[model samples]
Target: MISKTTIDQVYEAARVEEVIGDFVQLKKSGSNFKGLSPFTDERTPSFMVSPVKQIWKDFSSGKGGNVVAFLMEHEHFTYPEAIRYLAKKYNIEIDEIEQTSEEKEQANEKESMYLVSEYAQKYFEKTLWDTEPGKAIGLTYFKERGFTDETIKKFGLGYSLDEWEAFTQTALNEGYQLEFLEKTGLTIVKEQTAGDTKRFDRFKGRVMFPIHSMSGRVLGFGGRILTNDKKAAKYLNSPENDIYHKSKVLYGIYYAKQAIAKEDNCFLVEGYTDVIQMVQRGVENVVASSGTALTPEQIRLINRLTKNITVLFDGDAAGLRASLRGIDLILEQGMNVKVCTFPEGEDPDSFSKSNTYEDLVLYLEENAKDFIQFKTSLLVKEAANDPIKRADTIRDIVNSISKIPDRIQKEVYIQECAKIMQISEEVLYNTLAQINKKEVNEASKKIRQEQKVFEVVKNDPLVEKVDVQYELERKIIEMLLLYGNQKQKFEDLVLKENEEGELVLEPEIVEAKVYEKVYLDLQEDEIELSNEQFKSIYYKLIESLNEKEDFSVNTFLSGLNQEMVSEVSSILMEEEQYVLHDWERREIYPKEKQLGVAQLVGETILTLRCNLIKNRIRKLQEKTQDQHDDNSEILEEIMNYLQLNKLLNAKLNRVLS
Candidate 1:
């Protein structure tokens, strides 16, 4: 278990904005930062981060949380892993009792696998430098490709022995399980037709590349075979598991994220060596698709860091045509894409390495062209003198334009395309409009079908029979969260004597705080809030009123988890948005002394809950009504309220005090 002091330090040190900024490109908007939604495909930004509140809310997905919560959500780190990441980033030292061998045995399987993977990364790195075969096979391959020793070590390259089961046997002897090895795709198990099972290594005779998550946890591996085995595939990759999703991952992104953010443009290449060589040549903001077609998920991954991407392809026309489809996907994401090609026979790797960083930089700068122009010049030549082919090419460009989600951008591109093609803008506009109409019609038809089914299914009488009182009570609980801490009191009955020297009907004087009154009123009626969230809020308000201090929303809502933060922040913030404006704010309207309704309500509801909670606690001492109790100060206050109520009721009933 982590010490409480360490946990508190972790939470305090991990600023929400700073942590999330490492991934998302955020722009200031009022008191919050807004950016495109990382979890969805949207042109407009719906992701928000509030530094004052130390929370984030993705309006599109309704996900929100503090820094730790984001790491858990975005990178899928567990709580401890998230904490450890923050500690590392912030340079905080973590001192914890190490788990013994027995405790290690007791660890969960997932954790055990993580530990094994981490250990293997170290082992592979150690072997690369300390063993002859690793240095000969892996280091030689990397160096021959212009990789520095530092790059090889940084990427954790290694070589597996040619002997079958070499790594598997070592792992099993070290207390790691064969099942885990097979499950992780590090070892392969095959059965002979009429004999026993045969165990072999999956990455045998291949150089290894350990794939890592953003914070550098070894998630999986990619290996390239060296032997001429016609039956076996040359390149082997880790199977998809809990931690590895190929479509969502970019090779070398973990190391290149900072450089990408700094440069504000990612240099996208098609293979691993292309990335390593370019970066090794001082082009730091580079990543590879590892020879796969671009995916929206991968594009979103890049989108998280920057909105600009420049793709590097072989200058050969064949390579450009092959990669043209991927460029359309990039443009559709609202990213700025420029296509740059090398001299006919060269790719990004060879070209970048052959020249100095400055020369390569200048070369790419001169060669890069906007997508439409690049596409047109490259294709117009091929379709020359063929009117039908040229028309088909124009349609292809229009279709790519239609993929853009932004209206303004699409219009600009359409005008640009028309100008470049010497065609009428109206014709292109009509073509785009028709395509858009078809897509919208198909979408609307699907929505209507879904709506029709939903309407038919939602005719249940029980759905309409939900209690309104429960909803009102829930809202009251929310109101208490707003005004529970404000200092306000309600009028209660007070005792007085009549002119005849006897108790008479009169209004009683007693102070009841707003929060205490609300809490006690609900408690007195035994009205359990129907919603679990409201119930929790209610109990917390009572606890705070009993203590008589400022309520801590942070403490009250701790461990409610990420799924609940958005709902809770909405409920807590919606009633305050009105007061957040300029004219009604304190800084703007202090002379008028006008308070926005939300500010007023936020203040009032908090005190109301506080007072209600006070009343509920005072009622606990009903046994000591109108009587003095020296046991405690709270007991004395309870006696006073009881005595005051009794005297007023006696006066109303014409009874003696």
Candidate 2:
């Protein structure tokens, strides 16, 4: 187990905005940060991070928590893994015991696969540096490709041995399971006709490139064969498994995330070496598609960092035209894409390797053209002097423009395209309208078909009915969380029988901590929160507030479990989402919750009392109707509750009827 000291140190050092900003593109909204929800598919940003509170909330999926909870949810990390990740990111020394064999055996299958993959990465690196075949072949190959030793090691580039079953046997000897090795595609296991198992390294005799998740966990590997064998494929990737999906993973994202966020643009390349070469040349905000077709998931990964992408291409690329279609996917994501090409016969790998860093940066800046301009220029060459082909090209560009989600951006691109092709804006607009109409018709058809299978339910009255008690309880908790440590003067309402034998409420002035006032009011009435979660949090919050002279929401949250942390964060951040819209700038001023803390606290408590009294009155009337006997006592009790409720409502300025 990790030591308490280390965990507390991580909590203190890790900033919510800084950590979450790595995964989501956050923009400053008031004092907090807001971004698109990573937990859900959303166009509008519903995820919020409060640096002050050290907590985050996703209004889209209703998930909220502190830093650790965000990691666990977004990265699917176990508690210990999340803590360790934070520790590593913040450069804190972890104090913990190593897992024993028995403890390692207790890990789940996906974790086991991760362990095996990580172990394989280390084993390969060791072999590449320490062994004869690794140095003579693997090291020689990378060095020939212009990679320095530091660059190779920084990317964890390694070499797999040539001998069949060499890695498999060594892994088994080290007590690593064959099951996980095979599952992660490191070892290939097969059954022969003699009923014996044959095992071999899947990436035997290949130079290794370990693939990592956005959080930098080893998920899989991409191996390149050095030998010129006609029967063998040039490059092989790890097969689709539980943890690794090539379509969803972008090479070098773990390293490029920071630079991409800093530069506000990502450099997209075509191969692993291309990314390595560029980063080695001091261009950090770059990633590769790993030679696959660009995917929406891959685009979204970049989308989380920035809204701009500059795609690099070889001057003589055979697949240049084929690759142009993928740029449409980027445009569809509402990202501004620019295409850049190198000199003939040179790719990002060779170009970055040959040119000085300044020259390379200059070339990219000078050559990068907007997707519309690049597409039009490239396609215009193929359609030269052919009126029919020119019209088709115009429609193609319009189709690409239609993929953009922003109408203003689409209009801007269309005008640019019209200027380039020397075509009238009206014709392009008409073509765009036709394309949009077709798309909407197809979407409506799909929705209609889905509606047939799924019955629609509407107008459920209970769905709309406000749960006054629950809201009051929630409001009480919100007040306690926000103003619990604050000292304020309050007018306490004391119910009593007056000289005329009528129930009346008299205001008694009192000054105390907000938490103290809430606690005393609830204690005096002997009222308990009906919601179990709120009740537990209520007591824990009060205890924490009473104990700490300098209470912190984040520090207090660190002591609670994930569930309670989520609940408290959601309560605290619900109003923060509204604050993100800057309503004051729109000339709509909202009532600030902090300004009337004392009055809000009193009103919330009084509302709770009123709700409970109404519930008691309801139960008493039921009893009077059921018994039909001497319900005089119950009736008198009900009358007294009604009078008290009336007095409380009157004090609250609420209509009794």
Candidate 3:
């Protein structure tokens, strides 16, 4: 177990923004930092990091927690792992109590997999540096590509011996399980027809590249063959399994996440050597999808760090055509994607090796074209000298433009395309509008179908749902704000069951704030949140209710995690929609949009409805006999709910049909 002293030291030394900024890209949005939601696929920034509170919130996902929580959510680290990660990040050396070998043997499967993969990485690296064949083959291959020893070590480059079952035998002897090794694609196990199973190394006889998750856990491996075998594939990758999903993995994200976040832009490449060469040349904010076509999952992985992506493509016409679809996927996510094509016959690896860093950067800067323009022009040229294909090409570009989720981006691209194609802007706009309309109609139809399947659950026919009581909620809000500022006092009672069967109140009582009052009351009555958003708002409110000062909305907003703030802000602002505008204003009884007073109203209303429904449900549950049929019980509930329905209608100022 980690000591409290160590935890405190780690927390104190760790800067929330600095720690989180390594994994998620953050930009200054007022006092707090905001970036694209790491939890969701988004274009606009919704993830927020607040250094003041030392917490982050994803407004889109409605999840906000402190530094440790962010690690748990983003990296999928366990509690102890998160703490250790923080300790590692801040350079706080952990001095843990040693466990016996027997106790250490009790480690779980996932941790064992990690250990085995890490061991394989070390084994491969050792083979490369420590063995003659590896040095002659794997080491020489990397050096020939201009990769420095430091870069090789940084990327965890290694080599596998040509001998079958070399790694598998060593791992098995070290007490690692073959099942996990096979699952991680580290070992290839095959069953013989007449005898028992045979196991061999999957990456045997190849130079190795370990693909890592963002937190530096070994997810899988990529291997390249050195020997000439006409039938054998040049390079082989680890197959997808529980731990490694190729679509979601990037080649060098472990090294590039910080640089991408700091630079506010990512340099995307096609291959692993390209990433190393580019970063070595001072283009640090770069990663590769490992020579595969970009997936939405892969794009979202980059989306976690930066919104601006500069895709480095080869100058080969075929490679460019093959890779254009991936560029379209980036734009679909609402990210700004720019293309940088290297000189003819040169990839990023060769290009950077041949030119100075400034020249390379300048080459990319001068050549980088917007994905829409680049894609359109490429297809336009391809369709050239073929009139039938030209008409199809325009439609194809329009279809590509239609994939963009943002309205403004779509409009901008359409205009650019119209200029390039010598087509009317109106025609492009009309095409885009038709596509959008069709998409909306299809989306609406899906929602309607989904709703139909669950309509009964959404409505409560047995009882009238209560309207929220705004005034009482206001009182609670006031109490939370004021009482939180002051020390809380609550009536305390002490009871001893051993000597006497009597309960007595303690002599000294403490003050209670609205948060404590509400929280304690809910706990005492066994009340729980029925929805996740309300649950989030409730927790954040509870968190802030104790702060001693005048409430500042911006500070409150900034303190909450990124995703929840957007939602809470939107909800709080949405509640003021009933406000009388200047033109429509004749008499305004209650002032609107003044501040969080709207949020307070909305929260109060929601709280009242939830509580009222819960109470009614509870009462109905108690009265309903087990012998009674569902139809009769529901009828009885409706009869018993008339007064509550009248009260709800009166408060909401609307009748329920």
Candidate 4:
């Protein structure tokens, strides 16, 4: 367990915007920061981080919390893991008690794989620097590739000894199970004769490049053999494991994430060396496909940072053709992709090594072509002097354009393609239309099949209705969070029996804290929220207000678990987002809620009271119909509730539905 002092130190040191900003591209929106929702696929910014409150909320997914919670939700980290990540980010020393054997055994499979991968990364680095064979072969190979010691260490470059059991034996001696070892593909385990097992290292005699997740955890490795052995593969990567999916992982993302966000553009290369070499040469906003085809998941990873990606091509004809396929995928994700080809004889690794940082950047900027231009120029040459091949190329380009989600972008690309192909714009549009129609039909069929599966559940008579008061309960929580401590004067309407023996409303002015008024009103009406989660938070807010003069959202959130933080964040951010909408630009200026805090707070509590009274009346009417029940007292109480309900409805300007 991490000590409380360490956790507090982490929380105080880590700023919400600064921490989330590393993973997300956040822009200043008033006092808080706003960015596209990393938790969901969104075009507009719905994820908000409040620097003053030191908490973040994703309105789209309804996930919210402090910095640690964001890491857990985004990275699927455990509680202690999230705390440790924050501590590491902020450079705070973690005071953790060692885990027992039972605790060690209780770790999940994925975490165990992670542990093994991390251990292997460390072991490889030590071997590369500390051992004779490692230095002679592995270190020499890296130096030959022109990677500096600092660059290699920055990217966690390592080496595994050539011996079969070198790494495997070390891991076993350290108490790591072979189960995780084989699972992470670090140890190759085989059954030997006489019911014994044989284990060997998977990456023996190879210079290792550690693949890391966005938050800098070692996921796996990509190793390249230095020896010219005809039988062995030149490059071998860790097999697909619980922790590392090659298609989903991007090489050097850990080192490049902040630079990508800060530079507002990601530089895409094809190899691990390309990314590291470029970063070493001061081009930091770069990542590699790790020699695999680009996946949508990987694009989405970059999409969280910026929409603009400039894929650095090796300039070899075959390599460029292979990388072009990912451009359509990038377009489909609504990202603006550009291509930057190095000189015909060079790749990013070779080019960066030979040129200065300024020259390399200049070359990239000068040579970068938008995907449409690059595709047209490259393909048009292939279709030279052949009309049929040209026509086929045009159709191919049209199909790529159709994959784009944004209509405006599709139209713009259509125009650009038509002009370059010297074809009429109408031709491209017709081709795009046919492709779109086919896709729509296919999508409709899929939707119909999915809908049929859910139809029975939708029509089930046993489906429970949502609680009617949830909205009001949520609003009550919102009010308390926003303006609970503010002093306000409210018009307290009192019901008195007049000479006519009828209840009359008398208005009286009362001044008090908003929470004080809300508490008193709810207590007098004997009302409580029906939703257990909302009820818990409502009381916590009140208790915090009662105990402290200065209420801190961060401090309040520290006591709650992730789920409660999400619930409270949803309540608070729903109001914040509602307020953020620029209605004034549409000539619909909304009245600020703070201008009528007393009325807003009073109405919220009154609405809750009104709902409770209505429910009571419903039960009373049901009881009145019972043949064996005596309901005289119930009817009298119902009449009093009805009178109070009318006064509340009048104040709210809401007629009973």
* Cα-based lDDT for every prediction: 0.73, 0.91, 0.74, 0.86
What value does the lDDT take at residue 243 in candidate 3? 71
| Stretches of candidate 2 exceeding 4 Å from the true structure | 443-455, 461-464
The digit string of per-residue lDDT tens for model 4 on 1-657 reads 777777777777888898888888888877788888887877778888889778888888878988778888887788889889888887888876765545656888888788778888999999999999989999998999998889888888999898989999888778788899999998888998889988889998899999998988888888998888999988899999777889888998888898898888999888988988899999999999998999988898898899899988886877677677899899888899999887788999999999998999899999999899999999999999999999999998998898888898988998899889999999888888899899999999999999997998899998888776998888877887778888989989888889998777778999998888888888887777788998899899999988989887877787788898878777666656853575666798767788989888777776777778788899988888874767789889888888888877977788866
* Best model per lDDT: 2
Give the worst 10-residue stretch by lDDT in candidate 4: 575-584
For model 3, residues 1-657, the per-residue Cα lDDT tens digits are 888688767767777788777777677765677777777876666666667556566767867666666776777666677778888877899986654445446767776667678789999999999999899999999999988898888888999999999999988887778888897889998999988999999988999999888988888899998889877788899988877889889988998888887777888888878888988888888898887778999988888777889988887878777787887788788788898777789999999988899998888889998887788778888898898887788887898889878888888888888898888999888887888899999999999999986787667576556534433444454444333344444433333233564332233464654466567656664655555655666666777765534644444543455455544444432222232122335654554332343344334543465456656766676667543556575657755455454444444455655
lDDT by residue for model 1 over 546-637, one digit each (tens)? 68575555544444555555556656544233333435545654432123323343333333333344456557666456556554776766
Which sequence of candidate numbers ranks them by TM-score, best first?
2, 4, 1, 3
Which candidate ranks first by TM-score, i.e. highest?
2
RMSD of each: 8.7, 2.0, 9.3, 2.6
Of models 2 and 4, which has the larger TM-score? 2
TM-score for each predicted model, relative to the true structure: 0.79, 0.96, 0.74, 0.93
- The weakest ten consecutive residues by lDDT in model 2 span 454-463
Residue 21, candidate 2: C-alpha displacement in angstroms:
2.1
State the TM-score for model 4: 0.93
